[model samples]
Target: MTDHAGTAATTLGISTAGLDLEASVALAAEADAAGVHAIWTSELYSMSATVSLAAMATGTRRCRLGSSILYGVGRTPLVLAAEARSLDKLSGGRLVLGLGNGTVRMLRDWHGTDPSAPAARMEELVTVVRKLWRIHEGRVHHDGHFYHVDITPTGDVRPPLRECIPVYLAGVNPRMIEVAGRVADGLVGHPLFTLRYLDEVVRPAITKGAGRMGRRAENIRITTMVIAAVDEDEEQARRDAASQIAFYASVKTYDRALAVAGFAAEARAIREAFARGDLEAMTAAVPDRMIDAIAVAGTPRQVRDALRRYEGTVDHVILYAPTLGLAAPRADRNVRRLVAIATAPRDGAR
Candidate 1:
């Protein structure tokens, strides 16, 4: 499908998947030069995605930057707003802020932060951040269920920001989706999904949420993160996808996605295998059917065809190279190939 401007209707984006900081920054520069629509980074106990993006901002001339998602708990709302404002100014107003509730395991175990009523906290965070951006006089103060702050007029407080940064909420469940619809500019879809689950489960949930607020669902942008591997060696592509899916299944936070795809029992088995330190079993247990439903793999044409399933539903495709536990060179090649395939035009589209 072509837009009125004669370009592809849905733009292409790339996710820098927890690569080393140097490699990630280099990829951001390359993706920007190659005319990719956006670049997103994940923040899961690795190099901070925000810091990586800060480095990318200096090297790249175009290509909007985003956090595939940054967790909402660790930083105060004021700190988030300040960083976003600085980054937006540095990037010349090309930043999309994607926020999420970190997994319970990470929030509780690693950060020792409370992991209760996450959806409410996210709502409050969004509210506070926007309020900070809009403030003109006096201090920004919020008396919310999760937070309270009264920043008096100090010499350190910066002037009110002019850019209106877009906020996209990362959600997998119903209540989170409703919270996203009620407050966010967009919703971010996870990689562990089938077109069936997206069309049936995810879309309806967002629609219902939007309907409650008397908002049209179509107005809410949906940016989908999809696992992709394009290679002449079809077996290698599938193998990479299987390993990645198994890893995702091991995370209890993603069980809802598996359940939506009719693989709840398989997910439990994968988790059990993961707990027993049997990663091979986890990969093997990922049925080919599950892989076919979730990942876009194989040859370039094949991958493009698979991605068309998301054409009307997703406003942007955040292509992710999921070659977990693979050798570095091999994984890098997979990412390069997927980028080429994802940015290419549809066959015979002139």
Candidate 2:
């Protein structure tokens, strides 16, 4: 049961989740200068992940560029294909295309996509995108319940920078985790997940799915997004992390994580506070134990020690700036601290 994840070198990255395009681009540049492994953006009703990544690709020179996730059904396969190809070309093939199935409300109400059998829709999205990417030779064809496509390359179109851009699917549900292991290049663990959840449930499910396909689970990268609210003021840092955790906990879709981390009561408290629209009560519901189990929030030294635990759980760890009840400037400051934390030297040179 020991993942021994720390035995291998774990890459560190940063997420631009709450920042605007200008701030994100600037942070990406800074992270690149510090030699962080990758920089990721999120598309959460504020900005297009692809659009933000395009700017980041042009701004940075070394680090890999990615989306924490674009929703699975938000865009047509053709649109996604075009955007992914464009971003990859712009980044010189340094794109990791992350996708996910949004909550049922997001799918049914926001995007008008049917929410029934979401895993199947996500699988079809992945398949169709890859098919669209491989339009160099013969006609590409796909007929699925969620998507339909038949196309041929024309006008001597230039091939995409890479035949297969690494596709990372984000999810915590067992079915989605298994499907991600079967079809995608990586699994993006949500910020709410703990190391216990990753080892106890996520990894085993991925292994089972990969085995069914005769594929090696080791090849599928296990990446996690962590809520990191770094500050010299430890209390302020913890508050930021708690606020973000409360927000994620309020979403019923992620309630399973609370049970896995042994904090279901606290989660229920947070959800109740959320339903009452009391942000402070929601944040108050996040006990220190939950914060310690799921996030890094404190001085730089404390955060460095906390991150070592995750070194054992994933191939990559993305430090996300918390946004719930946090101001833009404060969130931006958190990102700067995360960059400093990520770029700090190890205790001893190997």
Candidate 3:
């Protein structure tokens, strides 16, 4: 692993794009062998991330396995705690539990939950999950605006053998980042985060939350998953990235983040362009500034240089490669390319 200023260098991880489960596990094992630090499986419209990571743990010995994100509203806190503990044991204590307040649409449409009280519900869930994991026996109780859980630990229940599993809260909004710094072990900085946003919005919110608990800034891990694509034809890579940006521009949550990144007007334009099905206009609407702000796609060296801007601020960098719903061979090639870029030495330094 590369070292930076006596700190264990930040390492690369991959985000499984809810595609092929078997291929995801194999690719994770390949990454572990290639010296990548971690592999994160995500849940959107497929198999549970916990199940996927459990399978991945059995396949690899060294790499840490985690959930890139699991929606907080769908599962009860106790259930989530149990799953996290089980995965921790199965991975020999290498599980990172990542949670998120899912998009408003997901809550309203998919889970049939109330989006109005989501933030409060999410906070209550985190508190309950932490207490459940830490306490061996007792009735866990909380009086939040939404989701109050009161349950006694069964006599057969046992505490986790590990001290604490790292919990990452994924959010880009100011309030969410603040809560993450206050309650979670780490912050999963949103995919749309830019250096300006990190410096202006995230850092201040994280500091505010950390200060509330008398904690220091360094206590929280800041990690981000960037949309990435590396190819000989850089223009093709850019086009692929623009497609993703256009999709996100239509989403309300991402629109707010884009606004925070000083691209609100551009994002609005892109959204308008996308709705018209004018492919050229959609691509044109994604300005160079927007592309540089959210994604890292180009030649390998160019990608690395772009990533370096985030090195000191982010403790981990999860590369969200563009093979989410693709065929196995294509996805595997994407994974291999990411692994190569991440593990490659810079300036010929060993």
Candidate 4:
């Protein structure tokens, strides 16, 4: 676990959307043995991120457990703070809470909350959570824009088990990216990020925001989620990755990111196909150019080279398995290979 260039050691992580608890823990254990640095789970309507991470934490010895994203809306700051404290203690301070202001559709439909002033709300959310964790002697009091916490327990209020848990913001757009840099302990790059977008857009926004706070950009750990599909059949790997990218592109929340990457027309077409319930058309709309730009696909060596493009720019590269099309064992096999390449010694390293 050596630091590189004043940054924490570049580590490999895996993202699992699978809901099966037993199998996910098994995968985490296997990844821990394989020298993977982190295990992240998503909160995409199927499973609870906290529950999933806690399960994986108990199962693995070293790999840090994370919620690739738990919607910041629909929960109070104190509740979120308590959840973070519990998870951090459960994992012995190896918990990283990746948060996001969820999509407008999901926020309204699932959580019954209007998605207005989301950026403002998210800013307060991060602030309040941090304040709650830092309460050492007195009852925490917050009269913020989104939440008010004035808890005065009668007898005893248990202080936070830990001082703080790292909060990583998940975003791709300029405003959200800037918020991440200004407030978050880290930033989780959206899966749709291309090398060009990271350099030209994401990094610049984060750096600018950090500058406002008189903070060094290096202080924020930048972890990117790279869509991956690796197989001996190189073409098949690309196909699987394309299908996954298409699914993400079809969502309206991600349209701005695609447009920023010069894929406005393609994203429009994919969304139209999606509206008409034509998944095959959506898949076809995802061009090879876009896939190569956004994902690390193809054979093992190809994936390795693709990841190297992010070497200096990112602190961690998380393998996002958009493998709804691949079997579990096959996806695991590919990720294990990718992790091996990521953790292997670079030139002149002992």
TM-scores of the candidates are 0.92, 0.96, 0.91, 0.92
lDDT of 1 by residue, 1-350 (tens): 12111234666788888588888888888888777778888787767877887888888887889988987778899888888888887787788899987677777897788888888889889989988775445678889899897776556555544546789898887778877777887888888867777777777877887788888777677787888877788888888889998988899988888887899999999999999999999999999898888888887778888877766557788899986898888888877776576567755431
lDDT of 1: 0.80
On residues 225-295, what C-alpha lDDT tens digit does candidate 3 reach at each position? 88887776788677767766766676667876788778888887877876787767766788877888889
Off by over 4 Å in 2: 1-7, 347-350
Model 3, residue pairs in steric clash: none
lDDT of 4: 0.80
Alpha-carbon lDDT of model 3: 0.77
- Candidate 2 on 269-289: residue-level lDDT in tens? 988998899999999999999
Per-model RMSD to reference = 2.8, 2.3, 2.7, 2.4
How many angstroms is residue 118 displaced in model 1 relative to the true structure, after the best TM-score fit? Answer: 0.6
Q: Is candidate 1 or candidate 2 better by TM-score?
A: 2
- For model 1, the superposed segments whose C-alpha errors exceed 4 Å read 1-8, 154-162, 347-350
Tens digit of lDDT per residue, candidate 4, span 51-106? 88889888888888888898888789988988888888888888889998777787
Best by lDDT: 2
